[model samples]
Target: MKHYLPQVRFWKIISIILALTGVLFTLIGIFCTEGALAVHWGSDGTPNGFAGKIVLVLIALMGVLSMFSGESFRKERPGWHIPVGPEMGYALSTGLTGCCAGVNVIVVLYYFRPDERIPAVGAIAIIVLYLMFIMIAFYRDRRYNGRDVKTGEESHR
Candidate 1:
């Protein structure tokens, strides 16, 4: 259980880093770009005028929320039972923070482009990365569960 504290701390740190990264990227986009950042493009690749800096603001806000959510997991009681224990709680909180922040980071990169168009592959890659984070968290949860069972220790305690 003591060793697990390090793992939990690591995830919390990662959450903080991700949130900061998202916020920084959004700030860069906000300052470097002009009015009406491209939010959407038409079939013909023309700007639909639906895109705006507001998207960046929304994404950044999500990033901030993600950071706080992860921190809350550290201090708050686990409201749900699916995660089962601290290990899973840390994993879920950290993974969610990373995924949300990653989205903002991706969008900032895409929107900051000179042409204001995001490469399809870049967008897809963000999704893939998020899935990878989920897998890692799941794996960690299983490992912690197994360890507790093998050691005859109660996971909740």
Candidate 2:
């Protein structure tokens, strides 16, 4: 068990980092309605700065939520399965990300064409992809099993 402690701790650290990034992105979106939208970077010519920021924030939140859910699965057996909240969050976040990625792929392919919705059609896709990656991280964590110290039981985390 002692040998696994360091490995478990490492996973916890990863979860913390993911959570922090998600919180940061969500906070960025929350504050973006203010003057944050008007600012411009180099000539990135990206989507509307404000909207993009908000999307990123949403993606981050999705990541954080998914991580929490996955971590829940790894917790002691008393509450590990996460039949509702965490499982739902993980599933939704991943699905959203996949959908967004699909949209972005289409948008990028047809970017040269002039269409009314062309510019922003794929914006959500970027956020979706970001969210999906986070979800995947959570999925991996959930899939990995770890020991429960108190019970000495071969529980899955």
Candidate 3:
């Protein structure tokens, strides 16, 4: 292993965040009353303020996933359970986040009156950041991961 590999341990921490956020989004859909507020409903839409909490939780989770994916991309070889590239893993984690964010935004706007402000700017920002993180992670993974050109297969180096 390269000395730099250990330096990226922080990235794994990030990945777990993404995975857990997916779990949170699933939970919110089931338990929260303010599913509509995800779009930005002020008060009238859904009785539950839980949607906001879920969104916040989701944002944190995605951010963590992005970081961890990047770390693993550099560190993980073609092991038993893992394939190659951070794309598949990162996408799986963040896709749910993006979907939930989209759904929340839509439902919030559709049901709630405009006069009521739920504030979706934070959610939008979170999505953008998470996406950016994934991009960076994938780029790094591409450089460090995958098969070596010499043998056209995974390289231990």
User: Considering every candidate listed, which one attains the maximal TM-score?
Assistant: 1
Best first by lDDT, ranked:
1, 3, 2
lDDT of 1: 0.60
Q: Write the per-residue lDDT of candidate 2 for residues 16-65, one digit (tens) a residue.
A: 55456445534544553333332222234443333344554555555544
Q: After superposition, how far is residue 78 of candidate 1 from its true place, in Å?
A: 14
- lDDT string for model 1 (90-127, tens) is 55565665666666565566555534345354456667
lDDT of 3 at 84: 38
lDDT of 2: 0.43
- Residue pairs clashing in model 1 are 39-51
lDDT of each: 0.60, 0.43, 0.47
For candidate 3, the per-residue lDDT at 121 reads 49
Worst 10 residues of 3 by lDDT: 2-11
- Which wins on lDDT, candidate 1 or candidate 2? 1
Tens digit per residue, CA lDDT, model 3, 4-105 = 212444344444454455455445544644533443344454433435444645554553434333334435555555553445455434444444444444
